[model samples]
Target: MAATYKAPLRDIRFVLHDVLDVSRISRLPGYEDATPDIFDAVLEEAAKMCENELFPLNRPGDEEGCTFENGVVRTPRGFKEAYATFIEGGWTALATHPEYGGQGLPKTLNFVVEEMICSANLAFGMYPGLSAGAYNAIAAHASDELKARYLPKLSDGTWSGTMCLTEPHCGTDLGLIRTKAVPADDGSFRITGTKIFISAGEHDLTENIIHLVLAKLPDAPEGTRGISLFLVPKFIPDANGAPAERNGVACGAIEHKMGIKASATCVLNFDDAVGWMVGKPHRGLQAMFTMMNVARLAVGMQGLGIGEAAYQGAVAYALDRTSGRALTGTKYPDRSADPIVVHPDVRRNLMTMRALNEGARALSYWIGTEIDVSHHHPDPAVRQEADDLVQLMTPIIKAFLTDLGFDNANRGVQIYGGHGYIREHGMEQYVRDARITQLYEGTNGIQAMDLVGRKLSAGMGRLLRRFFHPADAYIAAKKSDPALKELIGPFAKAFQRLQQATAGLAQKAMANPDEAGAAASPYLRMFALVALAFMWAKMAEVATVKIAAGEDVDFHQRKLKTARFFMEQVLPEHLAAFAVAMAGAKTVMAMADDEF
Candidate 1:
């Protein structure tokens, strides 16, 4: 059967309007019109597009993949048409500026729409996804002339974009990159190098492809500081800002990836491509981060989206497929066996998937609201605080969520037994596709390192406080409430463990940086669990108040139940993480080189 998806619209609304109360976004400068109704309408329409249009294409797109010949990529059947409809519907411009022909919606709304698209079709999502990141980079850092030439087309989805950072020689180490940018007499640069693993690098879906490439200038210093960003398009634009003559950039080959087969991951070669600078020279990494940070969050959504799809598949199978009888009694007396969902083990798998998915969705959307405040808020102090939260949470969202997403997809496959291993069942594909999210957009390992090394200690724990204070305040306020003690107790304990671990890691790092490196992965995981516990607590608090008022009693009850399950079952993992992190690097480094 084809992969199925029903956008979790109800939960999305609960998280946004009820839990996060995103209506506060309207108080920001440009989002005054973003009432609940507008958000509902946008989400409903985006859901229709994803469910009706993109979901059906997912299996076929995976099977067909993309075909490349003569340096041209033909997307899977229906992809171009779907993309045309997507752009024509103005979905691409939802969060862009009005001056650039965009609808100028808040990023929070865009986050929901993007999640729906990714859930429906991860491969197809990449085409527009990369463009949005490119649009952000240029809109934020590029000069007026560059933005004028690129932003409108990118914003409107008339053209697509790619960020070319990895080369054959360098993946994460920008200091090792050898791509060269030479100044020409015409005040433009000539870029020449090869970029590998460029997603949406060359495709037939759009008229042009804009590449934001990183290269080194002749007079530049050594390593990363010498690097600069350049805008090199596939087809050079005419005076009217339309594609006219071909640029020197061309696709050399496309990677045969393990998953997301429908998305073209290309190897691009630039032979003295005509390009213009973006931002100040030697500041390319700073500008590119405008895209990378957004892309990291977007990749996190990929994990959540795939997990949602997998959970749906698993739930549907569990309800329909009959297996051994229930331990207590027969759930289906009319049949010989009860559905597999009746089994404790199967229920465990399903609940684990559901708990992780819902918690991640809530955490991500909460962060999305912060993104809006960081960008559009009128107060500088509030904006700075929000930005700090974004910085602190980005790695957690990217690393922790994707790692669990892969696990959830695996659980979906396990829930289906032998049938899931086959292609037609579609559960296996989710596993394959989600695996890449952890690997790309900076490996989860790198994200963990970033969290422990850069974010945790930044500003003498000021960034950490963005998350720590609210969680601390919530626990302190609720600890005395007898009804909420079950939920709050575990969360409070975990939060305390996280604080102690943070301090412990900081002190250990002062003595030996290797201690931080050894502890970073577990430390990040522990931190992520606490952050999610905080989200679950907030959700439980909302559910508790709503239950008291007798509004949506069943929904609120379920929320409380799930929150309890997470606290009792999942949050305890923090103890193991904390213990491992506090172990330091002693045993890990005891073995000599080549001893293994």
Candidate 2:
């Protein structure tokens, strides 16, 4: 079974150049030197890595998974080699700070490359992906001495990293975590607790594992405010930055379950391990969030990646597989039956997947660009605006992208029909692989709540104002553009509905504390549908102009048509969601507690 994935470079370039406008990105401080030649070279290398090293291992890794024995975790065969290849390519640190041995590429470029890696092998990508987050957190908050010691190895993939926040008893509720970090004489702490659902927690891909564990200190405040971050390693690095003696961190077990089988999801026991503080004492949760926000967006990329992969596979199958004749005519008369691609419903599925995937890519890259601008922009106001945009869009990226990713993956299975259900065809693998994306990374539901409850009204609707105002103006301006007018009109209507929902949630919150929580998830979905439609409309605008230029005709036409499909079929879901939001808290709270 050869792993199947088309790099979608044309589509990627379309998003980067025509849709999101990456040329403006080059003007940012560190990004000024990111030449087109360099961009092409980097993407070319990334395509080769995904098409060769990573994609080949995806299936085998899924089948073999990881093995745990005697406190050791062994990754699937060929994963170690594939991961080594990944490190050698310098992908692990592609977007890290240049001062710390990183390539310092624009984060949006990294977003494109990341989708390729994940589409090729999401499980393997997690190893380095999580490490990048750890690297970012350390770069952001750790002291200069600590950064000097760890950043180089992590950036180069001499060491890998893990976020050890979730425990068996507590996942979303950090307040309930029981992990303890006792301060030691040398200013280091002894961390002792069990952490579960830790991806890349224990793996053979790297020599040492840098565990960013969250724990409570003695005399620390109770709940989340008291939680602090510690840099606990599997084997402590010596002064020379080499793995020295073994640390007390050991794998209790590895989880066995659905999807991303190749990823090492470990239950780690840190028994009185020597740990160094990464950020301020009693601010561990806060510090870990820096890592979490990065991870959340990265996980959202997983959705985009898987969706793209599934769409690619489904399109191939649809073009090749023969089935019932087209209702209109016999498109393929020479064959036993017309190809599935001739069928309207099949086209609907593929277009839905394609439209959603492209919309997500554009939006994700846009958000990634904002992340770069947030960090590297010269003006503080520019940085702040970009940062605020990233914050507002984070939950949408996590929730909506994953939701559509899962749906698209399942739709791919449907496109394959009976064969898709079997393991050999590989469609089921995609379906399974995509499932966990919705569950982890704060869960799409939690992401929704964060969007409506925290992000929308957090600053008394100020953040929502920043996002919607520009969108409103764009919709108002694009009304006369015939190609985008229809798409933008519905999206604009949805946007107004979102504004109404936003105000409704605020009013409900004023009346009842629980009202916000009940309306949060649906409101998030309503907003995301509109946001993605906005992206599709933007793409349609770009596509319409590019098609007029007479370059890449088929690609631009597909973009225009898919954007049309999204407006026709997908954007309408928000109307129902808005209706649901209008229904309010009583439906959710009315359920009896003992009903379960």
Per-candidate total of colliding backbone pairs = 0, 3
- All predictions: root-mean-square deviation over Cα? 0.9, 1.4
- lDDT for each candidate structure: 0.93, 0.87
Model 2 residue 357 CA deviation in Å: 0.5
The alpha-carbon lDDT assigned to residue 323 of candidate 1 equals: 86
lDDT leader: 1
Q: Would you estimate the TM-scores of all the predictions?
A: 0.99, 0.98
- Candidate 2: C-alpha lDDT: 0.87
Q: Which candidate leads the pack in TM-score?
A: 1
- How many steric clashes does model 2 contain? 3
